[model samples]
Target: MPPITPRKPQRRALLIGICYKHTHQDDWPELLLTHRDVDRFRALLRSRYDYADDEITVMKDDEAVPSRLWPTAQNIRRELDRLVRGTAAGDQLVLLFCGHSDQLDTEETKDKTEEDGQDEVIIACDAKRIVDNELKYRLVTSLHAGVNLTVRVLSLS
Candidate 1:
């Protein structure tokens, strides 16, 4: 009798791109190519990485899409939680962020003992910030053993 091989595990991805157009701040210039970069990366995931449309979640701020897909701090956290909520071992997860980022001074951050005395944050569409500690708690610390996680951050600022 022939041996039976195990099936491949599921793959999921969350892609976020924010242009901050609605911020209306003179200092925050709009990123002209953020959305395009997200779209291209999404295409690559679908074609090269074998990720299905349903398995990938995209949040962009350039279009008049639903508020749920606006890449706000709340929505980003919600989607990230959803992405990591239910998964067995061997599952593969990918998170891609393309937009502006900033470093908050130690006094402004909850973790004051940072090596650089600053907390890194990703800027959301509503001008909110998602700190690195929050992301680590949601994505890294919550993952189960044998699960694979990939994170890519492309800062436009």
Candidate 2:
């Protein structure tokens, strides 16, 4: 029998961290570590895992570069689509969300409800909430065969 060769896995990642600085007034305190954590993670991925700079997208609330991506619902959705859609069979997808997340348990919605009766949400930089169910539908459900998907949530509040 001929020896089998292992295929190299294609790597893609989306990193989101929000401090919610300009969103609200003195009501909710800002997160101090989220942005730095994302930076560290990005650096690690680039240095250790051999992931290219273009292969990873970083979205933060206080991003100074206007040309760079920000953490918004539409932007996140678009990047998620790109990461998932462009993946092949031996690809690896990494999604890391670090910031304020919410749990909404409302009886008003008809279609989207979680098993615990509370819908999980990730609060974006633009103060938009992206539901977990919507994420599942958009990113998870459309995963190609043999693609390895890993999701990590680091919530500070």
Candidate 3:
């Protein structure tokens, strides 16, 4: 008789990317890579699936109006928790992050290292680099500590 192995459950996907522009000439390598990677991933998930505009949240870097803390990483984590704690079982939940992935371990800023930090930090219209760590993953321990929902990350730049 063949032994049976348990299969991991799957959830819905939430995709986020920050491309276009980031740094200057000296930082071209990282910047260029980030853009290409983000573009590739965005095109992947957004193809063939007809999802409502709200279902798919997009945060892009614009010279005019970029995303701040509220609508950036905070929004992403909030949405993830809402789904995990809500009665949406059997329903898929996916979280996709695209950009430059870095390790933020400095005590001063280590606590808050989401996609918005170091990765998608852009010169917003208000001139602020969004911090990702502010999101309350502590209240909902099931997230960054490898909790509920499916997380997919792709880096082009």
Candidate 4:
């Protein structure tokens, strides 16, 4: 009788790029190359990492894509949830963000873990901020055992 071979692990990715083009705030000016960065990263993942098109979820602010694909706080959270929804040991997950990020006062967030009293955040296209604590909870702590996660942040600001 032939022995059974082990199944290959599934690899999934979520890529986000926000330009904040419509934002009126002077502090949050429009970014020129975030969308292009996402495109190049996606291509790299496809070519080098063997990621299928359907395995990657891309969210960009400067594109005329579907509303669900927009880089809003809600959409980002939803996609993150989806990325880690179903999986077992050996699954690989990648999260890539290219856009603006800022540090907020911990007084506003009421999170005491920040030693500097500042909470790092990634700004969404709609000017919403996702704090580092929230990200750690969602992406780091929620993963199953042996699930490999790689996170890359390309902050222009």
Best by lDDT: 4
What TM-score does prediction 1 earn? 0.91
Considering every candidate listed, which one attains the maximal TM-score? Answer: 4
TM-score of each: 0.91, 0.86, 0.46, 0.92
The whole-model lDDT of each prediction reads: 0.88, 0.81, 0.45, 0.90
- In order of lDDT, best first, we have 4, 1, 2, 3
- After the best TM-score superposition of candidate 2, give how far the Cα of residue 12 lies from its true spot, in angstroms: 0.8
lDDT of 3: 0.45
lDDT of 2 by residue, 1-50 (tens): 99988667788999988787866834336888988989999999999998
lDDT of 1 by residue, 1-157 (tens): 9898756787899999887778776656788788888999999999998889999999998566688988989999999999999776899999999989988887887686699989999988888888989989999899888889999999955
What is the alpha-carbon RMSD of candidate 2 to the true structure? 3.8
Q: Is candidate 1 or candidate 4 better by lDDT?
A: 4
Q: In angstroms, how far off is 154's CA in candidate 1?
A: 0.6
- How far off is residue 66 in model 2, in Å? 2.5
* Candidate 2 vs 3: which has more TM-score: 2
Segments of candidate 2 deviating more than 4 angstroms: 1-8, 25-28
The sequence of per-residue lDDT tens digits that candidate 4 reaches over residues 46-142 is 9998889999999997558688999989999999989988776899999999989999999999989899999999998888999999999889889
Error of 2 at 40 (Å): 0.6
Tell me the lDDT of model 1 at 111: 87
Compared to the true structure, candidate 4 yields what TM-score? Answer: 0.92
Itemize residue pairs with steric clashes in candidate 1.
none
